[model samples]
Target: ALYYYADNPQRPYDPEKAKQMLSAAGVSNLTLKYLIRAGDEVDEQTAVLVQQQLAQAGITANLQKVDPSQEWDMTIAGDYDISVNYWTNDILDPDQKTTFVLGHDSNNNYMTNYKNDAVKDLVAKARLELDPKKREQMYIDLQKMAKDDVNWIDLYYSPYINVARKNIDNFHQNPLGRFFLEDTVKN
Candidate 1:
């Protein structure tokens, strides 16, 4: 699961390297109990793929199906071994994805219970910058920091499509996969 690199071609999959890292970290007889929403096909597919991949390195993953209604509570209560879930952001801001989700007092910090002062500070500083370039750079730095920490792994971005009549005006879908009816007008 950790060997995956979709964008970075430089980081090729090396089973030997992974095995060595696991051994160095004093890992042995590794088995992951992967949790998945019972009715979620995507989560099931991802879990299966990850299980198969991890098996190459002798890591056995036991898939556990959980009720979707109780899944969030389980994750929030930290009762999961490894949860496969997605976060939906309300707006197009890096803070929604990184800081608000992974920061302290966040509702969705399920994986590692991760909280870093540096990340919080970066997000805070970025929020204050009026210069677009400066703000972008600050978030970029935050992204790099999060990647280096390797606390969270994003699998994929699901596509969302919005349909509207040709005559509709001011119809635009934000990156957050949402649009407001108030902004639209018949032209």
Candidate 2:
């Protein structure tokens, strides 16, 4: 799990501030269509919570449960104002998360459609950077930039758990949710 960085900005939940911002922007009775994948209990529950939160901010969110098969296409095509989804990187590298999800030229970007030249340059530099310190700094900068840009609101990270019997030897669980039983043995 990624821990919080010291320099990361804090955005406290303030429904009043959200209301004021909407009023300043001349937006009233604003309603957003929130797309959720059907059969996902977590997504449905999150949508309900988000709807209540948005209502407190004077904004309306209409939740629409969509089939799993069509969820990807709908989100990629920008058919919904907001979509509920989760992403888990296969490896513990910032490359896939940063470039594929936030980069402008990437085709895997859901509906964010966020485009920034600075972000693009930073992602490219971080990928090829040979210096560890430089790469880390670049990623830090990218995180701050992405947060400021409000690319997406991160709710929380779910933990993965693995259970096994006592006799199972060499049974290890991968943090990335992969299982390799080739070396595992039951004594």
Candidate 3:
């Protein structure tokens, strides 16, 4: 809902306002098709929550749960109206997080089909920038533009989990979610 409305974090959620907006737009009893990938409890539960929220505004969300493999293809092909899926920006660099997913020519840009010259330029410049401050500002602006554009819904944040035995030594995982197995020694 926040993503769809480009909501500001400072403002609280107002279902009545949303209902009024829908009513004003003559959107009562509107039905929208929603997609959810199979096999993930988080994704499934989130979709249901979204459905319930939209109902408050007199919108009916019909959810279709499909195989995880088919979900991407359907999104890329623009066959879905709305889809609840998970993505990981595992890399430490924001460039990897944004560019690979939101770049104009990005392979993973199927959901929004987003192509913004400013965003592309900022991402490009940020990649080559050596100054941390400059790079950080560029990424900040890029994210702000993306949110304003309502590219996608920002759902719950899930932490990455990895387990190892006590005997294991030098076990480390990069921010990119890569496991350093070569340096790991087991007693």
Candidate 4:
């Protein structure tokens, strides 16, 4: 879970501003149907949270509880305006990230139905840059392309909370945001 920040730091959430933008774009009466998996605990919680927030923004949000597989199919088909999901993103390279975000991949369920050329081009350039600094800049460009297109509206970055038995020793969490049981032993 991560919040998608725009390229410009000054741009903050302004509902009125959003209304104007949508209005200028000739978009109105936009009822966003939000699809979320039924049985998953985290998904249920996230769906409720998102529903509340979207309601406050005056976007009519309807929540649909569906089976997880069907949920993905629906999202992939661009059937809904919004979807609540949990992702385990493997942060590799910029290209790897785009595989979901830019193209037709499982990760990108934005339903924008846009094939952005700039996003794809920038990601390819980033991948070719062996220099870390150059690569970083390319990634920055790629991100802005994503933001400008509004490919995904990220909500929050989440950390895992773990509860272990008292007897477990050396149960340290890893930087990858998960607990490791490698050195752990029962007392």
For each candidate in turn, the TM-score is: 0.78, 0.91, 0.79, 0.78
Across 1-187, the per-residue lDDT of candidate 4 in tens digits comes to 1223344334566777777878888888778788888898888888888777656656677889999899878987878878865445565344665656675444442445657876767666666778877777676776777777767666676876788898989998754566677899999
User: For model 1, how does the per-residue alpha-carbon lDDT over 4-91 read when each residue is reduced to its tens digit?
Assistant: 2334323455667878889999998888768889989989999998888778876888998889878777777777678766677775
Q: State which candidate, 1 or 4, has the greater lDDT.
A: 1
Q: Give the poorly placed runs of model 4, Cα more than 4 Å off.
A: 1-11, 91-95, 103-114, 177-179
Arrange candidates by lDDT, highest first: which order? Answer: 2, 3, 1, 4
Error of 2 at 80 (Å): 0.7
- Candidate 3 local lDDT, 1-187, one digit each (tens): 1012233343245679988888788777788888898887888888999889878767789999999888878888778777876666554556665776567764656466777778888778878988867766777777788777767766766666888889999988775567888888989
Q: Return whichever of 2 and 4 wins on lDDT.
A: 2
Candidate 2 ranges beyond 4 A from true positions: 1-4
- Which digits, one per residue and each the tens of the lDDT, describe model 2 over residues 45-157? 99999899989998899998889878888888888898877888898888878888777765645468887789888888888998878888888888898889988887888
Best by TM-score: 2
How far off is residue 5 in model 2, in Å?
A: 3.2
Model 4 superposed RMSD (Cα): 3.6
How much lDDT does each candidate structure score? 0.72, 0.83, 0.74, 0.69
Candidate 3 ranges with C-alpha deviation above 4 Å:
1-12, 106-110, 128-132
Q: What is the lDDT of candidate 4?
A: 0.69
Comparing 1 with 2 on lDDT, the higher-scoring candidate is: 2
